[model samples]
Target: MSPAHSVLHAVFGYAQFRGPQEAIIEHVAAGGDALVLMPTGGGKSLCYQVPAIVRQRAGQGVAIVVSPLIALMHDQVGALHEAGVEAAFLNSTLDWQQTLDVERRLARGDITLLYAAPERVVTERFLGLLDDLHARGQLSLFAIDEAHCVSQWGHDFRPEYRQLTVLHQRYAGVPRIALTATADGLTRADIATGLQLQDARQFVSSFDRPNIRYRIEEKKQPLEQLLRFIEREHAGDAGVVYCQSRKRVEELAQGLQDAGVNALPYHAGLPADMRQQHQDRFLREDGVVMVATIAFGMGIDKPDVRFVAHVDMPKNIEGYYQETGRAGRDGLPADAWMVYGLQDVVNQRRMIEGGDAAEEFKAVLRGKLDALLALAEATDCRRVRLLRYFGEESKPCGNCDNCLNPPAVWDGTDAARKLLSTIYRIQQQDAGLTFGLGHLMDVVRGQETDKVRQFGHQQLSTFGLGAPYSEAQLRAVARQLLALGAIGVQRVTTEAGHAFDTLTLTAASRPVLRGEQAVLLREATAQARGKKTRRAGALPVAAADLGPDAQVRFINLKAWRAEVARAHNLPAYVIFHDATLAAIAQQHPQSIAELEGINGMGTKKLEAYGADVLRVVGL
Candidate 1:
């Protein structure tokens, strides 16, 4: 067997490589640079890890891994330690003495792999260490994780990542591999140029995460709908709910807690120690539903997260895909659920236009947002549309909400035109006067409310023009018009400092207003709700398939794992994944030797926990 293959089985405990992993590993190990675009949970770490081990054992020396987050580095190093590999990380979490000890170990050639942040990797002190290592021919490889951060077009761009090109210029002899889970064609080109990897062998894997069921709904009583979704489908399951702001994160977390869910809040506004503690709890404990803003999830390695819900629309499709990809890292069935409304579109657009970015940059951001809006308002499969955003074509995934419960489409051309005309006439009658959705809907539907009569909008020709349509139907039209750029949102502030969104017509409105373009919308009906529920007493591992006795064994193994994790002060998955424990339970391995060939049972883990696992299974 090849060195990479041997390392895969003996150290990482996987018998076979998935997708392009083996090829990427071999190419990089042979001293070739590469840019790898693989999906989440696609064994991305192994593409560089096996090569690092092989080169280190061949006396090439330690590999340097550029990571972004401190929690990620800590978890990766801890997992490597569990696998009996010598790995260390240099971050602020380590005090001066501990940092000194790690540097000494690196100098002594006792470490195989080292991880550090991009900012630290470019520092003069770290470069000095790299210089010494290079002088001795002790630098094996350079692996840049989350390489998309190097590109301004990427969802999570960091200025520090642009400095990483120095690695290529300084260490010309070392092979480099850049990896990211989420990137489109534009972002990919930027990464190649930014990192000076234009000629690197590119390995682009399929971006489909079939295990996740994508669901997007129209926002109506969003808090109540979110609560019902949790209680019905994901009760007692680990998940993440993302909001658009820190205030919403805190409020939603409290609401979930009040409803008896084990939920926690995480955002950048919190104290550093508090955020760290909350993240640690989410990772270490079970049934934790983290309600967070965009700051929370970027390198979380938790494997058993069953769902990722979006309470508000993301700024772009890339951000949405990256966040939703956080669920089902174990390749189990999970859900990517979201609810958006007309206001979501307005808020996202307003933020883009309100930014101080150059017009060209804002235009690109608007384009990205339009793509996300298309995904949200899609009538076909959500997975297909999501994949298309990344320049990938895919068949209809039967797991998505659209595929499971197809919503009927209706012609909203008339409704859209009426909504647009009302906004125009209202502005014409009273220059610079704009109305929000509530007043506009009331005026269009011919409801002579106090605000309607006070503004004298009852005499407008567009009044009662949309009286035939229901409020739900007209709201749907308004959302589609906003998404299509036929209308725009202008933020208005009252004398009392109250802010509200007002509708305005854009150039794109001319075509729809003249009936030259048709507007199609999904019919808002109860039949559109996608129903997914867990079996009453089933475990995460398909209790019906496991049978009663295996279910009991799985539960026992989990209890034992929790105890062991607490003793070690590490996340439970760091010890052994749920899949590994499920395999042990189902196969009923009687001897430690029988557990040897299991997927996650490497030499170190099998030697350490195999006997105890057997005892838990009543062997």
Candidate 2:
């Protein structure tokens, strides 16, 4: 049998190949290594799986998969089993009997794929087993999922991953493939070096997810703002609400529940079963809201999440982008919202600095956080700012809050000068943050404070210089300055408790002369546009590629997707990812090969419904 036919028939029970899957499988089966950076809902799994099947058919041993998350390993194994593929995982969660059984299966050449943690693969026992498998010619290739974790500098670093390089030295002949959904240019280089995959062919897909509408709101009455947002944008959609603290997650979840929302809390602090229960409910139930800390969504495969709301600011822009990317996997419309405040920035900075990470790493993290701050305080297009951070140029998406409700601009140069001078005079010897902008503005407006009198700050010429504005307007100006790099927020919550603090001037803010009259200017430049809304390579498809029947089938598949999405309370793609439906439409297959030609149609799926798809297209 041909390698392609054998691959479809033996492990996956399909007759054709999917988008880029055939080429990737062909390359890997021929012993070439690869690096695939596809979107979350993209069929990254099949790129390795099909090749593993082909290798096994060619008398190779089991394909070794290095996965970071133990739960993700179990999920892959379950899916493989349903497809009739021989796969098993060895991890800390496995019992002694299960471990022995997996080892025995590997020795007998009964398993085509063996998934293990990077930690376990380097162990003496696993090495010995691997040696035996190699002797019997049972070893196929090494597939590394979430390969970005190998970088100690990455957000999801795993020190154990460094040991994976040993797999190359020990098993020199076997090919390898590394895959991940998220990585910046720096992180991408780091991963290639860290994993010693310098020679691997890289497959970098576009990072844009136009289905998700990016939105950020200033944390003014955050709770009320969140309530209004939820009511308007996602009244009955399944979504995730992310909080920075476990306590806040619980509180917000309970509050949402009390207010008649179907919300549940999930975090690492909770018991394992409870967390699992919440996750399972989120995956299975329609319209369930999972209120969670950052711990909840890593390696999670839920695709149809309609909204991702951040109750607090994320640590960095990368973290925010990755977290929000989880929504709208099926190429459907979704929302990404956050309520941010200055305190959130201060707290996150402290957290990053106080951690055991190196100073250089902290500096990198700080720059990323500052970029996110710019997005929040930006009066321009939210989508434009978000895309620009990822190195993509975009026009302003006129749909976001700032675009719809443009902030009124007033000449605040003189006002900013006054605040800067007051801050400089009060904390002359000591540079610190005294209070929130409102209270500071109150003091500046000549409102008597016993503390101000004790310090005698009301006597300064800058004090009460700009009393025409309300406290809110003053606070807004201070925030704008901070965003514009005209002022620096003092890192208030130090190792010491909040006894006394005040805003300090930075070199960036020193240029605003206190008494100089300033002009009010608002200019929207190179306007950020709405997301580039199109299917993957939509423009590249030939006019002849989609015929009348194919077009009809595509519409029907989308209809089915929408129905399933509504019924399952999932984002449409979570039910049947866009790539999968698109593949079905593109290949009006009359037989299994034509069906299998579409990516993501593994053996089990093809065996079960290959004829159904062909029949639907009346082929």
Candidate 3:
């Protein structure tokens, strides 16, 4: 076998290349630079891993992988070690002795892959190591993971990633491959230019993860709805629940656990050891639910996560895609379920506008958030809208909530004008001292409560003009207007020194509130929401399609995987992914010959696991 194919089947457990893997590997191993854009869980690791092994075997030195995710780096090294590949990582988790050992291994050419964070890679000491390797002609390539972070326009912008351009500047001779799971055309171009990979071979794979069914729900009762969805669909499956804040993560995890969901909270505020433990348990155990803020998920390599539930919507498509991609990595059916209320929108908007990021960065963030809003308020298929954002086109998925239960389009022109007018009126009354959503909603919906009475809000011309709409309906219109840029949210400190959110009218508000522009918003009609409940059970529906014998084999395989993983101190999916086991069960192979043909079964895995798999399949 060629080096690529030899390393492919011998180290990694794969019988064939999927999508653009083979071609990309061949090009990179032949000393070509590559810019690969594959979706999350699209087997991106192999493009570099296989090539890294191939080049090393050909007498080239270690491939330097720059990754931002330390936990994920450690996991990748562990998985590679299980495959008997020579890999090590230099991140904060390593002690000085361990770091020196890894550096020594690289120096001796005993390591084929050395993973380091972008921050560590650009340090003076690390640069000296690279200089040494370059002098000896031992450098194989530079692999930049999550390359989009280098782009200012990308959501997860890291300043350290910008310094990575020095890789091309300093080591101009060595080939480089910049890979990312999510990036639009603009972000992609920025990455290419920023990393000096403009002339590299670009491989843009399909962004579709077909096994993941996308679903978005208008939030009515978020925690309750989340509980129902979890109990009904993913009761005993590995999953992730993302919230918008640390406080919310803690509350949601407490609520889920109180409701018997076996959920744990993870955020940056927690002690490092505790956070690491939560992450470790989420990875190692079966059916563990990780409730986290954005801090939790970038590098998670768990493959059997049955679902990713966003209790609060993400800031943008890149974030949403990256977060949701944490699920169903094994190629089984996974659900990307989210519930976004008007409050979620307003909260996210407040974060953007009040944040300390640069103005240009904030503008880009708003555009991305608007794209996410479009997805949330979509009347068309959610999958089509999502794919279109990434510059891909596809027919309606016929599986998303929009396809199964299309939401209603209510003309909110009058409601928007009323709400905008209310923001305008509230500001005028207090000499630009604005009020929050509750007060604004109270004034708009004709509530004669004590606060409304105390503030004399009922005297405003826009007051009670929105009586035709409920508080929820008016809030929805306000949220859409915020997204439309017709209005904005301003963070304020009251006289008592407590901070609060207030609605403010933007320049864009003039055109819409004056009846110059018509407004349309998605309203979750009672019937549509009812139908959504019926259609929301997609996972169970997919799982039940497996035959009885196949189901039994799946159960057996899962049990065996859990036991073996526990014994080896590894994740169950790392032993054998659910999709791989399903394939095994479907094939019902009676011998090692048949097991060798399985997709994830390479020489190392086949040698290490072939017999156990056959036994579980009752062969």
Top model by TM-score, which number? 1
Cα error, candidate 1, residue 567 (Å): 1.7
RMSD of each: 1.8, 6.6, 3.1
Clashes per model (N, Cα, C within 3 A): 0, 31, 0
Q: Rank the models by TM-score, top first.
A: 1, 3, 2
Better candidate number, 1 or 3, judged by TM-score? 1
What is the C-alpha lDDT profile of model 2 across 501-603, one tens digit per residue?
3455676675665444343433222223433333321321212256777767776766665664565444443444545676678766677776765655766
How displaced is residue 19 in candidate 3, in Å?
A: 1.3
Q: Each candidate: what lDDT? A: 0.92, 0.72, 0.85
| lDDT assessment of candidate 3 | 0.85
Name the lDDT value of residue 263 in candidate 1.
94
Error of 3 at 223 (Å): 1.5
Q: What lDDT score is found at residue 329 in candidate 1?
A: 95
Residue 590 of model 2 has an lDDT of 70
Residue pairs with clashing backbones, model 3:
none
